[model samples]
Target: MLQQETRDMDGHYEFVTVSDEATIAFRRYGTPGKPRLLLIHSLALDGSIWTDVISGLQGQAEILCIDCRGHGWSSRAPLSYAIERYADDAAEVLDKVGWDQVVVAGCSMGGCIAQAFAVRYPKRVSAMILIDTTAWYGEKAPQEWRARAQKARAEGLASMAAFQATRWFGDRFRAENPRKIQEMMEIFVRNDLDAYEATCIMLGDADLRSALSGFHFPVSVIVGEEDYATPIESARQLAKAIPGASLTILPGARHLTPIECSDVIAEAIAKMIEAAAH
Candidate 1:
C-alpha cells in the first residue's frame, strides 16, 4: 500500500514512495469526489511547490501534486531522461489511482510533460493548463547553453543551480522574494546533479510544437508578466497555434507563476474547468 503522511501546510504532508522502484513523492488535497487535477511540479523543485495552489483549490477540486522522476522523493530512472518518460510515469500513476480523465496543470518541465501526456494518452486528459512553458524552442538556443546540459550531468547539481535560478526568475522577483526564492533555488541547486542533468537534457531535446497542433482538448496558457524564460510572446504564440485555446497573463510574476501567483492561477483553472463542464 502507498504510505500516507501529513503536514500543516493547509493540511498536507510529505508522502514519498518508490512506485515500481521509481521515486514518487507528492501531496493529495481536497475531497476525492471532486474532479481530479494533477499538478506537475517544475524542474528542480519537488511537488511541494504546489502547496499554495493546492490549498486554494482544495474542496473545489481533487489535487494530486507530483514530483517528477529524478526529483523529490522519486528515484532515478535506469536509462536517459526524456519528456516522454515523465509522461509515461504520470500515466502510470493515474492508472494506479483509477482516474479515467484529469485536468493536468504543469509548470516548466511539468508543462512539457503535460503536452506529451495529452499526445500519448488523449483519453486520459480532460483539459490542460500549461504555465510558463513552450512546446519547443522558438529559435535555436545557444550552443554553450545546450552543451551545459551535459556538463551538468557530469559535474552535478552544485554548479548548475545558479544558472537555473537565474533563468527561472526575473531580477525583480529575486529582489522581492529573496527568502522564498532562495528556498526554491536550493531545491534545484542541491538536487542530485545526474538527475538534474538528465532532466535538462530531456527538456532540451523534447519538442511538443508539432504535437500541439493536432491536440484535441482545451489548453489554457498562463504566462507571467515578466517571465524571461517563456515570455508572454511565446505564450501567445502557443495559444494562437492551439485551436480555441485561451491565454492569461499574471502580473508581477516570473516563470514560477503558478506558485508566485496562485490565486490568479486558481481562478483561471476554476474558470477553465467550469467552461469545459458546461
Candidate 2:
C-alpha cells in the first residue's frame, strides 16, 4: 500500500510507487469535488514553487502539486527521464488519484512536460497554461544540455547556483527579495545530481513544436519580459502555434515568473478556470 499522510496545515502528502525503482511524492490542496488544477514545477525545483500561487488560489480549485521524479520528496532512480516519461508519470498520478480531467499548468521545464502530457493524453487536459517555456529547443540545445548534465554529474548542483540565480531572477527582484532568492537557491542546491542530469537530458532531446497543433483545448502562454532562459519569443511561438492561445508577458520579471509574479499567475489561472466553466 502507498504511504499516505495528510495535515490540515500542510495539505496532503503521499508517496505513490510508480515502478519497482521509482516512487513519486505529491500534495493535494483545496476543497474536494471542486474544479481540479494540476501544477507542475520547473527543473531542479519542486511543487513548493507554487506556494504563493496556491495561497492565492485557495478554496477556488482542488489543486494537485506533483514532485516530479528525482525532485522534492520523489524517488530518484536511474532512468531515461525523457519528457514523455515525465508525462507518463504524471498520468499515473492522476490514475492513482482517480482524476479524469484537469486544467494543467507548468513552468519552464514543467511546461515542456505539460506539452508532452497534453499531446499524449489530450482528453485528460481541459486547458493548459504554459509558463516561461518553449516547445522546441534550438538545434544546439542537445549539446549544451549534455554539457550541463556532465557538469552537474561532476560538480554537483552547488556549482550552478549562482548561474541559476542570475538566469532565473531579474536583477531588481534579486536585489529587492534577497531572502526569497536565497530560498530558491536552496531548493536548487538540494536536487540529486543524477535526477538533475536526467532532466537536462530530457530538455535537450524533447521537442514539441510539431505537436502543438494537436491540442484543440484552450491554452494560455505566460512569460517574463526579462526571461533569457525561455524568452518572450519562445512564448510567442507557442501562442502562435497553439490555435487560439492567449499570451501574457510580465514586465521586469524573469524566468521564474510563477514565484516573482505569483499574483499575476494566480489571477491568470483563476481567469482560465472561470472561462473553462462555461
Candidate 3:
C-alpha cells in the first residue's frame, strides 16, 4: 500500500490521470537514470502480483509497476475499460515518469494491454514479454468472456477465486505456496464489480492478431505449461505471429508466471536487455 508521492528506497508511488479521467496508480523502483521496465498485471490482479518478480529486477533496472485503471489502487470506476485505453495509459505514465523507452512485461490481461501498447506506441517499447495471454480468445470469446463477466456480476469476484486459482497455478504450486495463493485471493476479492465486469468484456472483444504481425521490436512469449486460461497453444500462436519472437515454457507452472516462475522471468528480461543493447 504505497501512498502517492511517498518516497522510499529512492523510489516512489504516483498516479497519473488517463484519457478517461481515471487515475492510474504506478510505483517506481531503483534509480531514475537506470534502464526501465514496465510491469502490467493480470485480470482481477494488480501490480502487487509482481512483488516477487520485482526483487530480482530492482537493482539492475528502474521498474514501473502499474495498477491498471480498474484494479488495485487505481480508479475502479472509469469511463471505459479497453485494451487500447490501457495501452494509452501506459504511454501517459511513461511520459510522466520520463522513461523514453522500456522493456514491457505483462501477464494475462496485462499482456493484451502490452500488445496494444506496442501497436499504438511502438517507439516507446524497446522489448516486450507476453506471458500467459492470447491475441484472441478463439471464435467463442465474446460469448465465453461475457459469461465469465456475468458470473462475476451475479456472484461477485470472490466466488471466482477457486476457479482462478486452478487456472493460475498448477496443483504443485498451489500445494507449495499457500500464502502466495491467499495473498492473491485477497487482491482479487477487493476488485470493484463494475470495473471487473468491464475488463472482462473488454478482453472478450479484444482482437490483436493482425496488429501483432506488424510488431518490429524484440518480443518473447512465456507461459506455464499447465496454464489453462491462456494455454501454451495461445503462447505458441503469439510466438508464430510475431516476427523473431522467442517462446519459453515452464513446466509445472500455470498462468501466474510472475509469481511461480519469477526467477526465470527475470532472467528472460535480462536477456532482453542484453539483446536490446546490441
| Candidate that scores best on lDDT | 2
In order of listing, the candidates' clash counts read 6, 0, 0
lDDT of 1 by residue, 147-226 (tens): 77667667776776677667777677677778877788778766776776677667777778887777678889998888
**TM-score for predicted model 1 compared with the true structure:** 0.87
In Å, residue 266's CA in model 2 sits off its true spot by 0.3
Q: Per-residue lDDT tens digits of candidate 3, residues 1-278?
A: 95333224444568998767889889887655566889999999888888777777756777899999889888887457878889989999999877789999989999999999999998888899998898998889989999998998888888889988888888988998999999999998888888888998999999999998888888999999888899899999999999999999999888899899888888888788767766
Candidate 1 wrongly placed segments (more than 4 Å): 1-21, 139-145, 150-156, 159-163
In angstroms, how far off is 203's CA in candidate 1?
Answer: 1.1
Q: Candidate 3: where are CA atoms >4 Å away?
A: 1-12
Candidate 3: which pairs clash? Answer: none
> For each candidate, C-alpha RMSD in Å?
4.1, 3.7, 3.8
Candidates' TM-scores?
0.87, 0.95, 0.94
